[model samples]
Target: MKLASLKTVSNAHNDSIWAVTWAPATEARGALLVTGSLDESVKLWRGDELEQDGVHTGHSLGVIAVAAHPSGNIAASTSLDSFVRIFDVNSNATLAVLETAPSEAWLMQFDLKGSTLAVAGGGSASVKLWNTSAWRLDASLSVLKSDASVKGSEKTAGKFVLAVAWSVDGKLLACSTMDGTVGVFDVSRGKLLHLLEGHNMPVRSLVFSPVDPRVLFTASDDKHVRMYDAKNNSLICAMSGHGSWVLSVDASPEGSALATGSSDRTVRLWDLSMRASVQTVTDHTDQVWGVAFRPPGGEGVRAGRLATISDDKSINLYDYS
Candidate 1:
């Protein structure tokens, strides 16, 4: 299937859509999309019409990360303010407020079991874990100083934690940092497991393959996307083509393809088996910050769907299949 932009919602957001995730469908509500923006607001959108369901504002700075709980009833968002806000998806009501000052925050994610939330602690050199039941710090997984760890980037100023992903089983957590180093950790043990190496620029986005626990993919400012064998901590392959920085990357729910948005004003589709981009959508006039494949679950929206948000102040939807 080829991509023909189905709809473009111009000025849907005031700034870049930094993160996006699909809320699974419920008996009462169709699947919704939760997006965070540099505008310092987290917005919920009705997936079908792209209508504003609601907006949650309180973050002092840009909202960098957002994830929907597996239960679909709740979601969590983290901001540059070092705060994580857990809110009810349906009502857009605040549920829990989590914060850590000494350990700053970046991207965040919830485990598949919906029992824990993971926050990438920027510069704190740790990934902080929170218990969803009590909304308290459960553990802190420290990054190691091993000789084998990926060397810090010479050009980058920070080892600031930037992105995070949890294994499908919720046992393994991988966090990427500003220096382009990815640290894999064993959540239950609170230990640093291994570091995935390759990119030499900030790794802005990372995701574990939905169907494989040992596979992880990362998007970096180095203009490349890399796949990893998480269990062995080895770089499997790298896909490079974006002319500018790659801001975000996501895997399709079926786990057969992936999507990426870049500062070059384009969104790309890659077939996992071929490990090559099959199509490029260049409708945006400015940087495209986030791209996501809608999670599969809704009864009616039974198609492969992709959404991209741009610094052009637009949100574009495409049919993936």
Candidate 2:
């Protein structure tokens, strides 16, 4: 597979764009792309044209993570202030405002069914799960306990959960921590199954394969991306080419390709069959923070699309073929 540049929007955000996700198609609209930034706002953009749909702001600090519900009608964003905002995608109306303890809401994602939301609880060393319908705390999957003195300090080398992902079946939950440990949990039983440890630095991003519930991928400050078998508790392979930290990763809908962004100021497309980067896009002048593939399902949506955001305050759109 190859990526052909479709559009580039300079200064797409006033500050570093930290998160990007695709909202599925609704009855009234086609699929939309949403991004969160250090500018403390979440901006929505129309598909391949890269046209701005709207911007919503209320967070006190930089928005670190944003996730669109599977239904596409709702979305959630979390900030450095440990606040999670659930809002309407089309109307831009605030639906819920959830405040986690300082440093708890580092990353978040909605389950495949949109019935539950899981957050990587930063200093808390747990995955915070929320019930979407009632907007209430549902479950907390604790990975490790922090040292008493370093409970909430960002500078501490504790088990700070930095990323979270759920399997397509919604049966497994994985959370990666600042210390580079990935914890796998059984969602149905609320139990910690085991910890996958290969990375020593922070594992900042993770995603489950869209095609396989047992295959998991992770990106870390170690400047490498690792693939693992979540069910068997083993590492499958590790790919390294980025000059700097591998910051984010997202699998394609077809499951044959993976896209990643890094602190090296480049976006890479990995071929799953070869287990190597097939294309590297150096369009951003600064670190690339987020990359997302447009979810399958809208009207007249046959072509594949990938979107990326960077610290250079820009957004890049590409056609995956």
Most accurate candidate by lDDT:
2
Candidate-wise lDDT, in order: 0.84, 0.92
True-structure Cα RMSD, model 1: 2.9
Clashing pairs in 2: none
Tell me the tens digit of each residue's lDDT in model 1 across 1-321: 456677788887788777788878888877787888889998888865689898988888888788888888898888878789889988878999887784478778888888888888877777888899999998877775545456655223465787789988887899998778898988777778877888899998999999999999999999999999997889889998899999999998889888999999999988999999999889998988788887787667687778888778778888878
Task: Measure candidate 2: CA RMSD.
Answer: 2.5
TM-score of each: 0.93, 0.96
TM-score of 1: 0.93
Clashing pairs in 1: none
| Prediction 2 TM-score vs. true | 0.96
17-90: candidate 2 lDDT, tens digit per residue: 99999889998899989999999999999978889999989998999999999999999999988899999999
